[model samples]
Target: MKEFTFTITDPQGIHARPAGLLVKEAKKYAATLTILKGTKKGDLKKIFTVMGLGVKQGETVTVQAQGADEDAAAAAMEAFLKENF
Candidate 1:
């Protein structure tokens, strides 16, 4: 498994558009990906699950991946957040 902690930088936070992008990225990986906020965690591949966390700008969230391509998944997700959000 691999994990990365990132702060949400987008002014709109992880709204529908960003959440949709996240889910799209997550779906490309064979690994299982999860996003964590506080005590809540949800599958990254599911748009609703990610949006349900109510992530806000400047808030910290953890991205985790498990399975064969965990490292690539984590790196891609981290890169996505850093570059896009």
Candidate 2:
């Protein structure tokens, strides 16, 4: 398993557009990906769950990836967050 925390930098937080894009990217990996906001957790491959977290700007969230290709998933997700949020 791989995990890390990343703070939201986008002024609008995740919203729908970015969340959809994230889900699209996440679907490429076989590993399971999840994001946590406080006590709320959501699957990265599901846009609705991600948006349901209600993550806001400046809030830090933990991302976890497990199973086959977890390392690659983690690396890609980290890069995506850095580049997008």
Candidate 3:
């Protein structure tokens, strides 16, 4: 398993647009991707669960990938967050 933590920088937070994009990106990987905010966890491949978190600006979230391509998946998720969030 591989994981990384990121603090949201976007003023708008992880709203609908980015959440949809994030889910799309997550589907590209075979690994199981999960985003955790506090005690709440969401499947990265599912947009509703992600948006359900209501991740706001300045909040920290941890992303975990566990599967055959965990390394690449985790790296991609980190880069995606940095580039888009």
The TM-score leader among the candidates is 3
Better of 1 and 3 by TM-score: 3
Lowest lDDT block of 10, candidate 2 = 39-48
Candidate 2 on 1-85: residue-level lDDT in tens?
A: 9999999999999999989999999999999999999999989999889999998999999999999999999999999999999
Q: List the residue pairs that clash in candidate 2.
A: none
Count steric clashes of candidate 1: 0
Native-to-model Cα distance after best TM-score fit, residue 82 in candidate 1, in Å: 0.6
lDDT per residue (tens digit) for residues 2-84 in model 3 = 98999999999999999999999999999999999999998999999999999999999999999999999999999999999
| Cα RMSD (angstroms) for every candidate in the order listed | 0.6, 0.5, 0.4
Model 1, span 1-85: residue lDDT tens: 8999999988888999978998998999999999999999999999899989999999999999999999999999999999888
- Candidate lDDT scores, in order, read 0.93, 0.95, 0.96
Model 3 per-residue lDDT at 13: 96
Ranking by TM-score: 3, 2, 1
Superposed model 1: Cα runs more than 4 Å off: none
Quantify how close model 1 is to the true structure by its C-alpha RMSD in Å: 0.6
Q: Name the candidate, 1 or 3, with the larger lDDT value.
A: 3
